[model samples]
Target: MAFGADELRVLRRALATVLHPMPLPDEDVQDCLRLAGAVDEAVGEAGRMRAFLLADLARYRGALPGSAAGYLELLQDALVGGYDPVPDDLAALRALRHRPVAAALLERCRTATERSVRSRLAGRAVPAPAPRGRLLALPGGRAADGEPERPKTPAAPPGPAVPPERPAPKPSEVFPPRRRPVPPVGRRVAG
Candidate 1:
């Protein structure tokens, strides 16, 4: 069965309260009720399921040869019914698939495992990455790389129109750059 997040949270909170040493307040009696009801239902359902599984295991064992009868009966009694069937049970069943009765149950168990896996995968949402080259730019002419564009400064007054293109100037000479002045020891600067 499936449970919502809120339901699971409530169940966990109820279990914590019930398991604590302190006595619960009268106001929290509703939580006690929920815990008791959930526990009782689970135990009752498990008992019924255990009976069914033991019966099914016995029926399967009866069809096997005398050599396997003892082992099958031992495994049937060892089963707790809530947990998964062990590797040995599956392996034994695989060897017995030539028989019609064992083949159906083995196929059903495999199908159930596959369906559960597929359902779990389908329930999750795998978010895709944002499409390439389509990101929205932030304000103030900043690129996605966080570098801001340098202002145009009107193209250096049109330079010399036909000076034959001299070699590039040094990086410091290319712009009027200045050292970032630090603040005074205590008082702040006004905006």
Candidate 2:
């Protein structure tokens, strides 16, 4: 959202208040509230527009070569809005790369796709599932089915109560750094 001169002035004042907060005048408070509301509305509108653009891009993509022109246009706009190209988009761009525009877009899309993938990999790992609690036998050590418990064979004795200490892995080891794969020189990959 582009802020007007007046809005920018108000924004600067509001930010300054953060470091040296005093009772803001009623006029300044109103301006700040209005600016915040405008920002929220702009953000919501951008999200809705992005969703619509993506849906349109998908429809154009589904049409393939026939809709190549429209798809490329929509993709360029979407990229400006921070859209990440999917595999289908990359394939389509590669197919149309004979055109100068498509060739440039293919390179741009590849960079954006790689960046998106690396960011996902660098993010936190999936959390492990919670451990389940042990279930106890029914009262009197009988099975839940009202049957007598079977006699168990003797088992080996337990080891030491405390487990042996082991060195913890480094953070890098837990989530090894990933690098984007580079195709060998002079060998272009299709699709």
Candidate 3:
């Protein structure tokens, strides 16, 4: 996740040009894409892919209820192009709470969402945010003090050595004492 000063400088310049209070002018969009490419390189394929998909899903989910102008058509096109709402997209739907369609879609997608994510979006407390933690942030090594934690692979804690498993007993040892087969079911023999 390390990026050089030069790399960050490039992104900063590109982002400065691309992101504006108003919508991006068409000409600067390529610069935005270039910044995104740099970010993808930093974060990696899966991270970038999920973020990209989630962003698109959020946009479409926001646009879904729109009947004004071309909004519906835009939403339809986005969906047709393989954008399905992801668990993160549920927050946007939640904002549209009064709308029945949003409610229904939330209900439908609730089952598909990872239980921890669903619980979070539903405002329910879950024990310790599952094993992976948040999708993008808080990856691991969060401190009990709630600081932003550095991610580290947990090492196995040192402990008493596992004593070697005893080898299996021989079959005769495993069976009842071999010399003591004196009695049948119907009658007892005097020992």
Candidate 4:
């Protein structure tokens, strides 16, 4: 969880770069800051990986490029990268009455989310273990279908419970419990 001084410095720089421009206004900037904070806290330093994507959002806003379509595309890419800053950025933009920017960013966020999901599925595609291979000839390598054989290892039995050893009490600790209050016998006099 600890970031080296250099890494922390870099994070600070990145945050500054992402936040410096007053594209929207004071209130919107505050909101964006809040959103960015939550996202940074939630994702930690690794979240910096997607920081560039958020910066791109700023650039997209400035140009008002491709009519809202361009903005949307960028937002989508940012969201697809799994960075929470996109939605927050969109909300802030909307609150500022930048409808076109908001709408475009939202669409992009949605599209990016969808594309990211699809890409993940694609990555998991893992071509069905090619039809044939020399592995089939090895023992336990293939079944009757000539498919590559897979060896199954039996699950191991539960290990013994290890009881932590307690250190013996020191001499002073043992004597404290044995001491009992003794009344001053002879002084119990009367009056």
Candidate 5:
């Protein structure tokens, strides 16, 4: 995400050469080389992965039509098997639906509303404030007024000194024997 001095040099050179190639600067040439190297590396990687993803996409596309048809057929079969069609004129069937306490509940609810409204209007209103007398101190340890007390933070104890990290062994040093030269394939070689 961050560009260093070398990347900056490359960027300046790239802009100069591509847009205005004549009387090109050395900085521009270095920039062009850097960009070409980066592009080549990216292209090499993309070439390897592009074919793999494309093949997977082709396979999914091939199967999509058949899967869609199978789902449609399944829905059709379910509807045919489970449903028993009812007639549009169902007034006689609907008339049987009724709650036993429906009429009694309605009468009680209407009487309760009338009693609540009468009681609310008859009740007297109250004024809710005490007269100013003795001012009590706030729970924050302030004297009868609002002020924040600064809580002291404890100092951190010193940590132990960290030791320097050791360098990792090079690949050649780690596997020296494997890198040694072998005799020609035709020759009978000894280790």
Candidate 6:
């Protein structure tokens, strides 16, 4: 979403406040709040538009070869809006690949789909195996036939031990001791 000049100015001031914080004047605070609201509204509007575009694209896709031009246009717009082409989109584009535009879009969609798949795969973490409970072996434990059991292979040595993290210090502990502690309310100190 694009920000207007005034919005940009307010945003800059808000960011500056983060680096060098002090009490913001009421007017500046109101401007920041208004900017935030405008941003939120724009984001919501964009989401709605994207949803409408996808629905229109689906309708055009359902129409098949008859709606080729409209479908292609919508698909291109959807791509620009960060919509990843699904299997249906790929199949539709492939069917229309005879046309130069459709062929180009098909290749583009294929590359985007592959990149999306790779990113998803890379993001997935391999789950570690669950720890097994300790097996109890009584003094007389042996194979059912009384035959001696084979010895199991030795486990690999563990890596270096990491120290447990210390809890965060309280706000009072982190802040420097007060130069002059304020007297309690309704209990003024005598000079």
| Model 3 score (lDDT) | 0.45
Candidate 2: residue pairs that collide? none
**Lowest-lDDT window of 10 residues in candidate 4?**
128-137
lDDT of 3 by residue, 103-155 (tens): 65556545545665776799975432112221221211223235544454554
For model 2, what is the C-alpha lDDT against the true structure?
Answer: 0.67
lDDT string, candidate 1, 1-191, tens digits: 33457557656665675465343343344444464456556545545655665555655655565435443433434331222444545677688777665565567556654655675699942221112221121222222235544343332233223234444233223221323545668977799
Model 1 accuracy (lDDT, Cα): 0.46
Q: Which is the better candidate, 2 or 3, if ranked by TM-score?
A: 2
Candidate 2 residue lDDT tens string, 14-116: 7776666555565776677688677767556555666787998999999989987778888887776556788999999999999899999999999887776
Clashes of each: 0, 0, 0, 3, 1, 0
Best by TM-score: 6
Q: Rate the local accuracy (lDDT) of all candidates.
A: 0.46, 0.67, 0.45, 0.45, 0.37, 0.67
- The parts of candidate 6 lying over 4 Å away from their true place are 123-191
Find the number of clashing residue pairs for candidate 2. 0
Model number with the top lDDT: 6
The local lDDT score (0 to 100) that residue 65 gets in candidate 5 is 42
How well does candidate 5 score on lDDT at residue 153? Answer: 40
Tens-digit per-residue lDDT, 1-191, candidate 4? 34556556544544564566323333433444454454446344333434554676677666653434555555555444444444455554565335665666656555654665675688743111121111111121123345543454443354433334634233233212222335666756688
**Which is superior by lDDT, 1 or 5?**
1
In model 4, how large is the Cα lDDT of residue 95?
50
C-alpha lDDT of residue 103 in model 1? 68
Worst 10 residues of 2 by lDDT: 129-138
Q: What is the overall TM-score of model 2 with all chains considered together?
A: 0.56
Regions of candidate 5 where Cα sits further than 4 Å from its true position: 1-9, 18-28, 58-191
What does candidate 5 score on TM?
A: 0.23
**Residue-by-residue lDDT tens digits, candidate 6, 1-191:** 45789989987887787677555665776687687667657546555666777898899999999989878878887776557888999999999999999999999999988887786799942221122222222222233335665464444455333334544233233222324434667966799
Q: lDDT, candidate 5, residue 72?
A: 27
Give the Å error, residue 34, model 2: 1.0
